[model samples]
Target: MTIRSSWSRAELGAFGEQVAVDHLQAAGFQIVCRNWRCRYGELDIVATDPASRTVVFVEVKTRSGDGFGGVAEAVTRDKLRRLRRLASLWLAGQDRGWAGVRIDVIGVRVGNSPAPELTHVVGVG
Candidate 1:
């Protein structure tokens, strides 16, 4: 986990997405896409859990400090609703279907520390 002292919002967000992807792959999830976007919104990460045969939609929030409250506060109900709708739209374009679907959120906190912190919440909303 290399931590930089400074980062722009886009850089931080992209770095966080990569960190989230690494975490998910380590947990045995197969990554399907990153930054999947449509007319509705964006899905940070799309993956499949072979063990559960489920499709997972991930939203990543990267923060440099405590400015944003926490996981829940970072992802609001309206955001979750938009994610749900986005997930459905993404699924519609897929050629295959899964037995289940889930929403996950990964929060990446990067500051002047040596390493960034990560919080992964599964099945959000």
Candidate 2:
């Protein structure tokens, strides 16, 4: 595999988002959208959990190393607050209704192994 350090931040994030998407799909979630953006911010991935019939808003953080902090730590309470608002905005634009809504965080760490490492925190909101 190519070295993670060689990739730019955008590239790394894009790769990580793809990884997160694949992981979610494998875990039985139906992907609704990826990289949903608005004036306030962006939602990395949006999915529907078939079992729960809920809309899932995902935030993905990608890092080559823990120089700053763990990938999950990149998302703070303030960030989650903003995410809730963003999720509302996204939900407003949707035509279908969900049983409930949830916010999740997926952290991707690369460069140390042959494949990327992912951590999923469900119902963070």
Per lDDT, the best of the predicted structures is 1
Which lDDT value does model 1 have at 72? Answer: 74
Q: Lowest lDDT 10-mer window, candidate 1?
A: 108-117
Taken over the whole model, the C-alpha lDDT of each candidate is 0.90, 0.89
lDDT tens digits by residue: candidate 1, 40-113: 88899999999989999999999899877877799888999999999999999999989999999999888846
Pairs clashing in candidate 2? Answer: none
The residue-level lDDT of candidate 1 at 118 comes to 91
**Each prediction's TM-score versus the true structure:** 0.96, 0.93
Candidate 2 lDDT tens digits, 28-64: 9999989889999999899999898989999999889
Cα lDDT for residue 6, candidate 2:
88
Which ten-residue region of model 2 has the weakest summed lDDT? 1-10
RMSD of each: 1.1, 1.4
